[model samples]
Target: MQVETLVVVPVVLVAFVFYLTHNQTGLPRVGKSGPFGFILTALKSITSFADLLDEGLNKYGSKAFVVPTMAGSLIVAGPENVDLFKSSDDTAINQPISVDESLQLMHTLNSRQLALPFQAVVVRTDVTRAISAFIPEILEETRLAMAEAFALPFGEKSTTLPLFHTMTHLVARISNRAILGPSICRQEQYLHDIIRFAETLSIYGQLLTWFPRILRSPVYFLLSSAFGGPKEPARAIIPHLKMLLAEREQGLENAKTITDFLINLAPPEEIADVKLLAMRVLSVNFGSIHTSSIFGTHALFHLATLSESELDTIRHEIIEALESEGGYNKASLAKMRILDSTLREVGRFYALGVVCLNRVLIKPASLVDGIVVPSGYNITIPLKPIHFDENVYPEPYKFDCFRFSKLRASDHTDLKYGFTTVEKDFVPFGLGKHACPGRFFASMELKIMLSHLLLNYDLSLPGGAKEAPKPIFFNSHVIPDTKACVILKPRVGQAGQDL
Candidate 1:
């Protein structure tokens, strides 16, 4: 009976998956469609996602198509359907649901707080509005954090370190200083545990997708046991979060940190839920730390590849801005137009993924040309192709750091060309209503870090590499080269204190 049951279950699952794969969707399906065709396609997506996207675009121009993966089939929408993202009906088209599905968040996160809107609400409203006020602390944290991480002595000697790992630490510390305040953000153990939690959640999220839906729960349980789970790290923040909550209740704390905003804005019933609040903080940390660190590393790599004259041009801009504004503030950072352009160009050159505006339809929807897409389908836009479209951006293949800066100067449109600007062609931060809420804070943070690095040290790729390290693609995700090294040499006799 046991042997018969084992064989029967295997056959049943294969048949069920095969039936689902063959179900009619009435869309042009890309790649093979055999019983195991989805598996092959899934592998291709991990190894050559760009090639797969190009193939879909070439075969089915400006129309929706299906691309199968381990998670499920995705409806790859073309540029013509970009307006689908502008819809205001959250019930019909949900971004959070899409995130939960793609990241397996329901299982990986193991927390109900993710379903709540407290984090997004606070970030979009409080954190963003309070950025100007947080700039000084953020800048100071960036300075101290960088000095400690790089430790390039007080001479001409250079220091080499793993760019991605180092950037992750710096971002985590600086961002936490604003979120948790100085009291808890600098705690080495707390930062380490939270960082580990974020990594564990992401790793397990992807790993969970490798199993059939029926087997995922069992696999997750075993995996959690084998490789300590997100819980261990998540629990590490609770004690500290509890203290903050107590302090606020006792009138010993002010409404300054991100945690305070969350507590103030959270629904009345969940206001004092310590575990939920910790999860909310972890979620924020994951998004801000991962995205900012990856972006900063990319920008620094680009800086390393530029000519000495180009580097000087950026350095001069920073110095001029600091001098004119009398210090590093929001206005001074804004005046560093070249630096902003470089950061924007880095985003364009290497986006976090090959697709964006990911959404899961809750009800049947119609896109451009009146094409109807049924419910329960995952939809995403071809982000990389639109970014490289020559029709929108002249010479899209070249890495011109001055691309947007020149546009800002020639066209006299400052805001349109800024790093945080989101359009159909530039959707690194997504588009329309559901765009990343923390973008305002992230823009200021990246600008400050890049400017500080430019002013304090000369950056370069080790071994005189002409180009930045090539980005690694896992499925549609674009990961910066984690093993690449950047040599940082302190500028001789140049004081870093002024800026």
Candidate 2:
């Protein structure tokens, strides 16, 4: 009467059914075409799928399938589909719910409530209106941030430092100035707390995604309480924000920055929710710091590795722009075509987000060629394939600092360099209506940081380190491997030039 026989029978039956269905379905084979192929396919795809995805796209044209995880299948859409998917009119087809979910998970861990303040205040506007109100405040903060960063230790060193860490600190300072204004920006502890809070939340958010919903809340509380979670930072900063809001209400009459805009524009419901405001401030910091830092490092690293003459030419362009305009401003920075091209090239080569631009199919749709895609199938664009295509960009592997500049030079008609524009071919800031709204501020931040670094320091790889830093890919997103070091040294005569 042992129960062993009963358990074994059901287990065997289930296995047999799985085998039959897996074979009969004729769904895309992920790895080797054999029984139980999905396991091997998933392993292979995750390990080196970028190259494999590219190869599959080359062979299959517009639609190919890759098995990135055994949990689900990835539908690799072609360039035409990329255009359609990005510009999709249907909500389900272009859902932003995933990002929203991630934000909610962050809120749970921090024990903070969620609010959509940004959607009401910022994302509702067209680009022109958004930029007009925000750009000047961003620029003013950029100057203050640059001055603060240079005053720190290793601030004026000519020796190379760790690029990612240095850039992170610099961007944090910049973001604090923009989001919190000058008084809070000068507080060292507040700046440090913001950086720590962002780093902690990112790790926790990733963890919560893999666990069951019921377990997330309790687990988050345990982890966050053990570590100094968002609560600690919120506790410290909430009082300051309240004071700031009170001061503003009392007619301080400062220039209308993001903080002021959010306070004034968010719906009463959202404004009453302090947690939502905190989340918005945190979101801005998270978006601005990591992204601008990566781009800033890439641009600096490329400039450092170039030959002396190339470096001199770029330097001359910077000096001329500065002299002509008498200083760095939005208009003068825009005129530095060489630097623009260099930054664009860096973006093209080192885009951090990989294959996970998820869109849930809203309706039965077909491509121009009549390939039918049923509703509810998730569509994803593999950024690396588009970025590395030899047809789109000749000799895609070679890092030509002037690649975009050359394109612009040959065809001044090409408007890829314009700040507010986006395209399928170049999507570092993403594309369509949901594309990053803060790119103008990001561009100014990168330009100011680079302009300051180039004018003040000489940078290079450590002696005997022959190669530039290479990126390590996780899933599909590419990140600079932190193990590589770039040395920086202050220029001899340039020490006090700007000071």
Under the 3 Å rule for N, CA and C atoms, how many clashes does model 2 have?
7
| Model 2: per-residue Cα lDDT over 1-499, one tens digit each | 5699799668754664343224322224345655446546555654566766666666676664544332234556666667776777655565454444444444443323233435333533432254434445555665565455444355445444677766777777766666667677667777677767766665566555434455567777887777656665565556655765778789885644456555665556545767656655566666677677777777777777877678677777788777787666656677667777777887778775566455655566665456666554555677766777899989998877788767777887446655335687777777776677767767766776676677666667777353568876644456666666676665658522342
lDDT of each: 0.80, 0.62
Which pairs of residues clash in candidate 1, taking residues 3 or more apart in a chain or in different chains? 46-475
Best-performing candidate as measured by lDDT: 1
Measured by TM-score, how close is model 1 to the native structure? 0.93
Model 2 regions lying over 4 Å from their true place: 1-29, 32-52, 101-157, 200-203, 222-229, 362-369, 374-377, 418-420, 464-466
TM-score of each: 0.93, 0.82
Per-residue lDDT of candidate 1, residues 1-499 (tens digit) = 6999999788967865774475356888777767577667866766787788888889988788887765667788887667767663668777878878777767766446446766888899999999988999998998888888889656638999899988888888999988888877788877787677665666677767666677678778887787766666566567777787788779887788887887787665565667766777778888898889888998888889998899888888889888999888888988989988988987788878888888998887888778898888888888756888888889988888889999999998879999988887788898777889998999999889888888888889989897889888877788789899899987856744337
